[model samples]
Target chain A: MIGDSVPQGDNEAAAREVASGPVIHIRNLRKEYTSVAGVIPVLHGLNIEVMPSEFVAIMGASGSGKSTLMNILGCLDIATSGSYLLNGHDVAVLDRDTLAHLRNDLIGFVFQGFNLLPRASLLDNVALPLVYSKVSREEREARANEMLGKVGLAKYRDSQPNQISGGQQQRVAIARALVNRPQLLLADEPTGNLDSHTGNEIMNLFKELNERDGITIVLITHEVEVAAYAHRLVRLADGHIVYDGSSHEGAMSKNPTEYSAAVHSTS
Target chain B: MIGAMLNEAWVSMWANRLRTILTMLGMVIGVSAVIIMQAVGQGAQQEVQESIESMGSNLLMVLPGSSTSGGGVRMGAGALSTLTTNDAEAIEELPTVAGAAPSVSDVAQVIYGARNWSTQITGTTPSYFSVRNWDFAAGAPFTDTDLRSVTRVAILGKTVVDNLFGDENPVGKIIRIKNSPYVVLGVLSAKGQSLMGRDQDDAILIPITTVQRKLASNQVAGSVRFIMVQVKSAEAMPKAEQDIVDLLRQRHRIREGAENDFTVRNLTAMANTAAETTAVMSLMLGIIASISLLVGGIGIMNIMLVSVTERTREIGIRMAIGARSRDILLQFLLEAIIISIFGCLIGVILGIGGALAASGMTGIRVVITISSILLAFTVAAAVGVFFGWYPARQAARLRPIDALRFQ
Candidate 1:
């Protein structure tokens, strides 16, 4: 029933219609988990579209299935029902290995915990994703070094993750995510584990990467400050998008139901 | 991709050096036990084989009436002597018979100047040397004329020479046997031991005529205790044994309806039985050692399972980045194989060292064969693949989302 709603107004759709194609397009996506209690549904026919080079932030409370959507967008998990098209290819039909290839070739992931291998050197950690891509050693090192420099951590490449500060470790994870030069970057609570200062610094870096590299980014965060960095904001409430509009407008609106003004294009 | 997996596995294992070594201990002990047992078993078999070969080929022992023939030639004491040299001479003329020598043995004191030694004195014709594959160290053996004329000539074995002459050449030297002076004909070469662990070079050889007439005079009218027969080939052994039995029976004037007065025993069959026994022993040791290897493999499997559980986050991160199930499987399997290969190398060294130590400390012969080492390595590889597979599969089967969510 909720799939019929287009939360954004006609003007926003008219603006996005000029882009050649959508990088991510999902229709009636539903996911379920079986437990001893019964089948617990996580997503209820959620639908969304993200265009190329678009920076979209997803906001929700803990159980609103924002993380589940991020997983599906990154190709890490499949929807139990619905169609997800990544790079114009249906992800539901792709096998596990092929999905892995799709993720490797097109998507990058950043997590709240940094997710860097603690024992590996910063350089090695950054080069890890390229290893799965079967990149040559010399090429992997060259590309990893370039990404580290881009993240402003070039001098500490040899240092281990545990030896670095939390902010620096997250930057290293960003470098790793970008090392594959993936077309889409997916970040889940990228600044959730940091202080306000370090978190702002990271958000600025993401903004710079999105603008300068023209890389499409889908970020999931509940904080208003973190979501404000993205141009477009998508708010999920009970497994459906309650607000889809400008990030500034979404952050200023205190209550989700108030997004009706943006949805209906009314005062 | 596989190379990267191998590098990842090496790095992971090296990150936990102490744990890796501890987990490898079981494999080390198991492989070492297998190697040591195989070495000792093969060593024993080789020693037995050498002794069996040294005892000559296609041999048969002919015993007199009312005597039982065991694996070796048993000299009956106080039994009536029924066979003579004439019977041996007649048997040698048969088509399958190569040569035959009638022999008599007695333990007597031998004196060379002031040095005196009590040793076994075997009396037989010169044909005994060929039939028993005996060789001389110094001079020639006594000829046929010496046996017919009852000449006092003797051939001393290595042990007798060492005891009576102290490294001197005993040939042409006069030695007294039971107070009768006899000229030493030659010194026999060293023959290590028999299948029954008897020293083959500890006695003396003298003419049968001389021993029967003067030194041991226990026999009645030129009769001897036993005859040694050598067949032309291994295939002729059974027929030659039968021929010798019939010839001896006819020579002793036994009727067709009556039981034979002498028994012919095939020495080759006895040696074969000894060989088979040692082979069986070697196989048994190998089997027992493999059980310990199995235990070691189980230890590897257990430790790998724990490692997979502990490294769930690492697996998730790799999978999120883009590692396939096959890549994860290769990574864990490579880790297991590396541990076991290193364990096997250390085990081989320890096993060889143990075999050498056992040989040095004790008098038992130990042989370390290359085939045994190869067999151990093959088994170790098999164990690695066998035990490492299950844990690797588990690691590969983990869902990326669940693993990433895991604490």
Candidate 2:
């Protein structure tokens, strides 16, 4: 099925084999923090794999370790045990410089807080990642504009983050993430800070990227309705994965529209 | 990448408009004060040196004074009248001596028409103006014929011309000095005011022979107040002064252990002392100016740290979006340097204005050298880099997860 999704050619097959081997491969990953009282464990040896072109959502209640796993996968934090392989690079053994390069080349992130630089315009915010990549200014601007257009924020490219609505800001964040063209898109509660309608729109954009451009996306959310937008859903409870399968047979089998409506009315 | 970082810094500063403006204000005032004080001090020193140079470089002055005893008691010793026209003649014979003149000055009330003015009348020989380097604005100086014949003639300085003559031409006009009528032969050029705020061009010059013969007969001939000797070259001034001193001492029949009655002062030594004093003052002023720049640098550091703290989440976001620690550091550092450099540029403008204004008000010459401007700018940039480093490092050291979690 993954081969069928790839373009026809020996070069395309090689690219497919590399991409589908698992952009994110985790094995018994664990994270803990030392508090004033004692050591506090967050993720208890969680294991997961995300293939190419896959749209997956990790859902759980508050403090269910889903966010902790997302952080480790995004390279923002390191695991306390086991290992994480991102694009076949061992993240645990990489130095700070290589980790930075890995984050820039392989991972794109969307946050719950939108995290757009408040002082920068939408286009400048999107072009920020390319700054570290040493890309030319013209290319950076062009790619930033293209990303903004893809996210339907072209007209508001010059607007500061505060000038736009929350939904528009999220779209800007999305464009910034896609501008780098990373192998994996990791989103930590992306819709957690937004209204339901805006959340749905963002998820729909992610869906389009997955279907049309074969960009892999891994999103973290507590709400089951938000998870239904992903083709695969993983449930976590008590710092461990409880279920991992196709979304249609498990969480998505429930009435997701009612849940979305409930969240919208409350918002 | 540097461009993008610089742009980020610029935008961040503009976002908090009031803070940035206030910080810039500190830098502007600090830099302006430094440049202005330096310029003013330099102007004053240059003015003093120029004034001293105008008096003549190799001229030496001999004044009469005796060493005081303990408890400031006056000694009943007979006065030594060693300095005379013969001594002036002897010094003039020296190959190194260009010219020598004897001068006597006394305060006198001059009456001309309805106007009365109190002025110093300097009784001097024909060579006084040449030895002293005085220039005339109109007419001519006293001739040897006038000096030998004891003619009642005078030369008026600019202040005297303006005071007694007003709009009328003072040359060839008659003025009464001590109730004796004297014709003004010439008007001296304006010499401006001295550092002590004394009007330099306020005195009148008359032939010494005439003062001794007609105006003040009690004042003995060849017993003038002081003698001024001009040397042909600056290098020969010391030897000329020494020869004059030795001849005067021998003529007075002074013992080997006795102090000479008259003291000879070399113009070069006097000018050097004045320059050293002014140089010390300039150094002190420069140090004070540099303190303000230091304070400005501290202000930048303080503001940058606050900015970093305020934008914790933004730092986290940038990190997540592929910004390295060095990138954050470079951006913030560049922002601080830009502000300081801009402030320094504005300071140069204000400093030039201050220098020109001081020159106009005090008649002092101020030169704004390009090296001073370049040095100030370079120091300002260095200050920015030095002070901005800590804050940038603090921002860069923040962990992405912890920063994002910061409320």
Candidate 3:
């Protein structure tokens, strides 16, 4: 009812009226893959805007253009024909170096694979982003330790990634993602490789960080339970946004029983 | 930024310790080979010059006719007595000529009491001692008056003194030469060996008057074997040689374009020839050794290429974390420089040790020059950069997405 009451232009105009615009603003975003079979369009005129301090989960099945959308949002890939402005900077027009700087200064990424440098200790792995920021060694170590403490991996500061369990490795990755104090956290299936219990813990951690620290989080997942943790739910189908509303309303209206535990806990 | 990159490079090196050491071995051998070869060559050249100088740098031997044989008899240079006492006197008057000695040598049996020895007998004046730079071990040389009066006073060389006198005082003793008794005047100082490997100390010195009047009176009067002329300085040798030739030609009344029946032997020329040969030899050896340095550079390039390919994932992670292309390039380039510098330092120590060892084994002195060490060090660093560039570029050019996906 709220989506039907307002026109798309009026919604975008409202979003732009805020003191600081949305963290992510895209209009008519499209991406096509050029292979031996010519061009295959993945995302077709997809547009989404996430305001500051909001937790949103993008849910989609395979070939639903969710991953491609995440990549474009993360500045790792460019859109074919569209406008994506991240934090008031037009990402499509930015050069490679500027994109790298934007990523370093504002964006943090956590992958499902728990991409921690294997040889680096837990502390070093977290502190790596600051090395590029030119932070002093002592300060980097202190900040990294503080972040590790937040993730409850303070005792494993010197332990290598391989020496830790899968759940602990994910915690270390989370610590690394927050060590730079990035405003935008982009997680592509952050707990895809973890067990169900560990996945619940990670989701709770993400919920706590978004609620307490006011860090905007954009997570991509196919799991209905994972989507239930976010306040806003966005579902992609056939490279187009089919649903965007409160997770509680979406869960109850679409498939309530399957994500009932996630819905009840979050509500 | 540099410090951070260096730290990272250091970490990488330690992570692959065996590979680092193996890569450095090639540089070490290359640098040490260059250093040792240069040291040994320079040392040999120095030894040759020193031995030549010891033989006397300012000496010139004016012989009869040319040294080469025209008729196949090979009678040896200075066989004809074209030189005379008057010719020696004329040469001594020249401003560039310091001194001149006219003398003749013969192998003869000299007996002193029960000890008898066959030795070379050179009969000349006291000026021969000063001209030859000879010193006395005991007593004094025969005076000029001894030559004028044909006195049979002799000076015994160290070898002759040891042979005939058996460490006894040879001065004021009498020795018989050609059955003629000559009183021993003094002993000449020990001269180990001549340039020709002759035993210079196993000889005797006496008055020229005694040589012609008493020893070889049957030959032409005042006939000299050769004239030993000492130039005032090495710089004056060419002028003195020319002056002596002009003067000798006029004195001999030889016509223009005719053979003057004399030759002047320049000892410095001989020294220069020997020096040039050694220098050229060392240069060739240095070039041969430098090939290994090139090979070492190639080895570095090879290792760097492998490193770039093997660490592709690591490179991607760093790029994703915010490392610029330049940062990745700097990390690898700095790593190569560190390895090369480490190899250079170790190679210098090894090279000096090798040179010393070679010297001990061969009994040849090796001179290590600072220039060679610096050159080898600079080359080692350059080899790292020259060879590391292509691989570092390859690593830097890798796309983050592609590298991350690379297994």
DockQ of each: 0.59, 0.59, 0.39
How would you class the docking of model 1?
Answer: medium
- Top candidate on lDDT is 1
Cα lDDT tens digits, model 1, A95-195, are 77776766766789999999999888899899998888788899988999999999899999999999988999999999999888777899999999999
- Per-prediction share of native contacts kept: 0.61, 0.72, 0.30
lDDT of 3 by residue, B315-349 (tens): 87777767767778888888888888888899899
A14-114, model 2: which lDDT tens digit per residue? Answer: 33446758888887778898999899988877677788889998888888888888888988888999889876667887765556666776688888888
Error of 1 at A123 (Å): 0.7
True lDDT of residue B225, candidate 3: 84
Clashes in candidate 2: how many?
0
- Residue B88 lDDT (model 1): 84
For TM-score, the strongest prediction is 1
For every candidate in turn, the CA RMSD to the true structure comes to 5.9, 6.6, 7.6
Q: Model 1 chain B — which ten-residue stretch has the worst lDDT?
A: B71-80
Model 2: per-residue lDDT, tens digit, B137-166? 998999889988989999998998888989
lDDT for A11 in candidate 2 is: 27
Chain A accuracy of model 2 expressed as TM-score: 0.87
Give the residue spans of candidate 2 off by over 4 A. A1-17, A134-141, A248-267, B1-6, B67-72, B75-82, B111-116, B166-174, B194-197, B232-238, B354-369
Q: Give per-model TM-scores.
A: 0.92, 0.87, 0.82
